[model samples]
Target chain A: MRLLLVEDEKELSRAIKSMLVLSGYEVIQAFDGEEALALIENNFYDGIISDIMMPKMDGITLLKTIRKKNIDTPVLLLTANGQVEDKVEGLDAGANDYLSKPFAFKELLARVRSMIKHYSPIGENTHISYGSIKLSIATYELAGKESSIMLSNKEGKILSLFLKNPTQIIPFEKLVSFMSCLDAKDKEIELYTSILNNKLDAVNANFKLAKLNKGYKVASL
Target chain B: MSIYGDRLAQLEAIVEKGKTLIQEIINEEVKTSGISPIEHFKYRIKCEESLINKLNLRCLPVTMESIYTNIHDLVGFRIICSYTSGVRTVANKIISNENIDIILSKDYIKHPKPNGYRSLHLIVKLKDSDVPFEIQLRTIAMDSWASLEHQLKYKREIKHKDLIVAELKMCADEMSSTDLTMQAIYDLIKEEN
Candidate 1:
């Protein structure tokens, strides 16, 4: 999963970035909300973590700005003030989750995980497990109870999306955007899916892709 | 220029044109016949990511060449009506104009899906634009069934999922009948008046 971590404290920012990196997230650091917006213009992240107190562009204003632009990327606001009203103000301004500072790293990690899951289409899941099938993003592998093998980048990215929201119908257009396919047609989608299905069968995975409303869905067979 | 910028702009214009054309048709029909057939409608362009996914899924290449030709729903709309007959009335009124061409049409209301999904689908080409757009015509009941079906089906983590699926399908059938009965009642009132 990719994340934008915004904090004015250099030491604290480094601490969180390194911890998130060690925990298998791709982290981008911004010193304040101003820098965060600049980064956001050029990049996309699964989730964002920003501190309420900052050098320029306070977190509340930043949250309102992004929400006004209809950017639904999940956000977790960090604040030194743990008051109910402060949290309410953040939620009212469209923050997804909130955490108080001087907090446990474990709690922060937990909040981040849930935020990513809540916005599952962004594919923040490095590890996706469904039924007996297990897919690893870092290793680029899909494994069944009996076997495991390496996956091509395309296969891995597509599977990553499927695993994150197995029940959701991934529209054909979304799959193309996610995979960055240069060209595609519905028939080609069927062909690619069948090829992937054969590989899944070889690995003894318990599910196959299903067609729904001009899109594909993953369901247990 | 960005890679998909041109195609995205084209799709935006297509959707805008479709919306305007639909409004114009509705206005003309009301002016000429007094009773407007269309209840409400909504239109949108498929986002770049989604349009590409659809192109790829259709097995069409995801290139600019395939974007407009193979992915038909890059620009689409849903036309909602209060009565089942209103759907066809509005569709015919819109397409009967000499400048409009009905490239393809499917009467799904007459032949519901196995899961009980029902709607009339039409692909239309304007006089000026070579790229076609999709239009779905459905009654209020049918639209309700569709929206609920989408909500229930996507939340796979919910408990009693199979039971809920079965029940939702049943509800769709009920809604389909309700649509017919409602239309019949409306016709009876019209005949009396």
Candidate 2:
């Protein structure tokens, strides 16, 4: 899945992005709230992880703006403070989840997974069969008519996202945002495409991962 | 002798004594209590020195009021941990001693300040020492934001004091969240490990 990680601390952002990439997620990172807002406006993201203390704009303001735009995407607020009032404020401001800083990578992953599962389109089964590809959203398992391979979460989420929005070009930013939910450091859009290509190749699936003018597309070949 | 020289001399003597006291207490804690070497070093030694330097300011009074009211150079230690829960761990550990008097206590994590600052403050008197020192415990993120805010607020125009204050308060709130999230993340990682 693609995700947008909004954070200002360069070292921490880099660390979080690295962790996400290692988990096989495509991530897009923005240093400030304004940048995050612009990315949200220009593309679609499955989730957003934002830091509250930032220059240009703060996380609350960014969340408020994203919500005002009527964007239904799940947002997770990251703050240094774990005050109940702050948590309440974030929730009231439209954050789907909240996490504090100096966090462990595993908890973040769990929270992101929970949030995605909670916000994912209901009635959509984890198991979906289209043409020769049988995708398992829960375990990221993929089985082609002729062969099968364990797809990375990123590869599986990409496929699933495409399955949900067939024929639509998933923008690079959106992919980054979705992938960030699993991990935020892997914002290298190019790397995810390559990884997806490799996974798809291994499964020998009939789906085509294509790069559009500004985004990516999953086409059933 | 100039008043400035006398004050500086007094501060220097107090800092010297404070450092020695901190080291002694750390040694005692290590000998008697369950505390990590890093925590002992950070909470007792480093934080104590930092507080002394911060509090022994030229402006603030050097009398008892400095120890009770001021958080800067007059304070003796400020341990910035990774979580709010850790504050109690440190506090309970420190207050276990029979002689250390807990003169004042504030759990800002449980009840945050109106400005959204989150920290635990303690004023305690050492058994043998007549002077009381201030201790402020917060998450590392909170401490970082607070330090940054202090640096920023003093470096430039004084007109944006209100704006800076609000921003700092917001930052403090964010830091508190980060502390909890980090603890959760750490616990998750630990479980996986």
- DockQ, in order, for the candidates? 0.01, 0.00
Judged by DockQ cut-offs, the docking class of candidate 1 is incorrect
Candidate 1: regions farther than 4 A off = A1-221, B1-3, B158-161
Task: Provide the DockQ value for model 1.
Answer: 0.01
Tens digits of per-residue lDDT for model 1, A1-221: 77999999999999999999999998999998899977765455678999987878989888898766545578999978557777899999988899988889999999999988777443445677777788777866666664454566676677766665565556676665554446645544654565466556545678988777757877687
Put down candidate 1 lDDT per residue, B1-193, tens digits, no spaces: 5445756677677778778877887888789867667888998776767776676677888677777667667678999887877887888876787777899998776556667688999998888778788999998888988998887777757898678766776576556645654564566556557
Q: Using alpha carbons, what is the TM-score of model 2?
A: 0.37
- TM-score of B-chain for each predicted structure, in order: 0.88, 0.62
What does candidate 2's lDDT look like per residue over A24-61, in tens digits?
Answer: 77799999989988887766666788888899999999
Q: Cα-based RMSD of the predictions, in order?
A: 24.6, 23.6
Q: What's the count of clashing pairs in each model shown? A: 23, 43
Best by lDDT: 1
